[model samples]
Target: MNSALQKSSSIFRTAAMQVRHTSVTRYIGTPPQVRISTAEKCAHIAVIVGTILAGPAWVLVHLQDYKK
Candidate 1:
């Protein structure tokens, strides 16, 4: 039992050391800027808003069935 405990503790220590080395992140530089036309911007906003509202709209439309 003592040996098993030592083995598990050693395994956990090695895993912790590996995790410390792997979690490093280096930022290179600023990302490039993107340019979009007014129409394209409007389309993107419309799509995003539509997606956000679709779920609630669906639930409201089917709320009676859910209550039943």
Candidate 2:
């Protein structure tokens, strides 16, 4: 925190002087390139499929009970 408060210009008076380069590389890898393992992929697929099935079943059950 002390280092951050200090001005970069105060440390190096010369404009031409090359300060240390801070690399912007992510500590964690980029998202799209990240791989999902086989079991994880299956689990995700199961949730989507379950939602699809459950939604219709839920509607049917409620429609029976709450008929106009």
Lowest lDDT sum, 10 consecutive residues, model 2, at: 17-26
Residues 1-68 of candidate 1 have per-residue lDDT tens digits of: 99999999999999998888777544346764777789999999999999999999999999999999
Instruction: Give one digit per residue, the lDDT tens place, for model 2 in 1-68.
Output: 66754666555644434332333332556577868899999999999999889988898989968787
Model 2: residues with Cα > 4 Å off, grouped in runs: 1-32
Instruction: Score residue 33 of candidate 2 by CA lDDT.
Output: 80
Residue 28 in candidate 2, Cα distance off native in Å:
20
Candidate-wise lDDT, in order = 0.90, 0.72
Off by over 4 Å in 1: 1-34
TM-score per prediction, in order, is 0.50, 0.40
Candidate 2 at residue 18, lDDT? 38
What RMSD, rounded to one decimal, does every model reach?
4.5, 10.4
Q: Please give the distance, in angstroms, between residue 21's alpha carbon in candidate 1 and its true position after superposition.
A: 20
What's model 2's lDDT at 14? 46
Which candidate number maximizes lDDT? 1
TM-score: which candidate is best? 1
